[model samples]
Target: MLNPQWLRSFAALIEQGSFTRCAEYLDLTQAAVSQHVQKLEERLGPLLIRRPRQLELTPAGHALLEYCEEVSAADQRLNKRLSEHDDKHGEISLICPGSIGLALYPMLLNLQQTNPGLIVRQRFAPDKEVLEGVLENRFELGLATLKPDDPRLLVSRFTEEPLELIAPVSERVEGWEDLKRIGFIDHPDGRAMSSRLLSRYFPEAPGIGSLPCHGFTNQIGLILEPVARGLGFTVLPRSARLAFQRPESIQVIEGPRLVEDTLWLIHRAEWPLSTRAKLVVKTLKAQIEGLSLRNHACRRA
Candidate 1:
């Protein structure tokens, strides 16, 4: 079995670039840190390092650093798991976009109410950050619109959230011409969503940047505020539209059906998710299905 203590010392030394500093951080003597590295090297082969005055890593050391960090993180997670003595109660860490998290909050609350022993810890971030959190094992799962490009991640199609063109309640939108005239308020995902929307509805329209962009904001929940005040129109996912502060102040424009963003649940492929994590995933899947069914019924009615 691999020694987590030795791996921790190796990683700390690489980060600090000195046995003395690493020892100080770990509350161990400098000699202890040196011995830890020597023991690790004996077992894992030479993690080559060149030292004159300052420390420098060889190619082998550079490669080993990534694995060591991963192992150290895994050890930390394992320790936390062991501390939770009750198998019936555990924590699930999740990361998702702000808008999606808002949309799912009610269902999450209901799940928690039903199973009081299960704890769900959630953080809202941009899609990129959410994916990074999952890859780093900081979160057990991530809900994101972007597909995972890394082979190390396992992604499952969560839901296809339809995108809608929205404008202030006072404005009347007929089609693409009105959009061109009114201009747009850009969000973080605005450019990409605009590209896909124009491609689907206005095939011959100019490039996304050619359109008048009033301003840009990275906050999804706040992106529609300007649009609602009649500053401009914007395309946002259904979840974001619902989460907007003034949903009644804005209305979805009637136009050709546009593209939708697919939210996928992403996680590290090799990590075995805890039972609470699995339960949260199942609950989310059911909630999405129910939401879709409700929307479909509303459309029919």
Candidate 2:
């Protein structure tokens, strides 16, 4: 019989594509991941992985990945059911992009005050990780801007936010001509998001309208500090823009806007929401929707 643990380790190896990387995910030594794969292959009596190559799966390995995904999903459903009936809402984990976490996490914290007993674990990750985590049941809920795939992962878009242009108050101008005068404050990933959004909004615009984009920071909040000091301007989603406390010094320009990005609430479609999970999502929607209105008010005020 193939060891289930070894199968799981092999799954990790497939995901990481190398023993060294799998070691980090499983918190196991590189030798251990290799040994687990070796044990798995021995039990099967043939080569599972095409070695001397970078973790290419043989036909057997391909068959095994499908089996593991099904088993892993079932195992998670069983665990969730057991936890639900135990009167332990226990820990409900939700993973989302860092931008959503900034705008919506307070609502999660506020939920604790209402129940006083439910445990909420909010994990911040990028968009792709968040979606995959939801699909794999690594998290009960996830928020992301995704391409929208899979019936198992039900996604409900909550809002679409436009990107706002910002420049230093000192260099603030009312038009696009002024936007071109100073260098643009480009957040590495933020620029990519903006580029995609712009392409989406204006497919026939003039030659992609070049801007001097620079600066690499993973944190969107950090981008504002330099913008406030007149460094340069960048386009960021409205949700991320609200996180910055300083609004007066930084000018939000109307010349160019980013394509709206979708914020979807996701959960497993096959499983009913846990009582606590239902409550959390309810609270989240109300909070986020309410904030959307308030944000509009603030912008218009």
Best by TM-score: 1
- Residues 1-301 of candidate 1 have per-residue lDDT tens digits of 7677887898999888788899999999999998988897787777855567577766667777888877878877797777454434767678998778888877777877887876778898988899889888888889988887888899889888888878888888876677778888988778888788767877777767777888778887788888878889888878788777777889887556646789998988986667667777888888888887897788679
Top candidate, metric lDDT: 1
234 in model 1: Cα distance from truth in Å? 0.7
Q: Candidate 2 deviates by what RMSD? A: 11.5
Measured against the true structure, the TM-scores of the candidates, in listed sequence, are 0.70, 0.65
Question: Tens digits of per-residue lDDT for model 2 on 87-174?
Answer: 2356668898777788777777777666666677888788878878888888888887765677887778766766666678888575
What lDDT does each candidate get?
A: 0.81, 0.73
lDDT of 2: 0.73
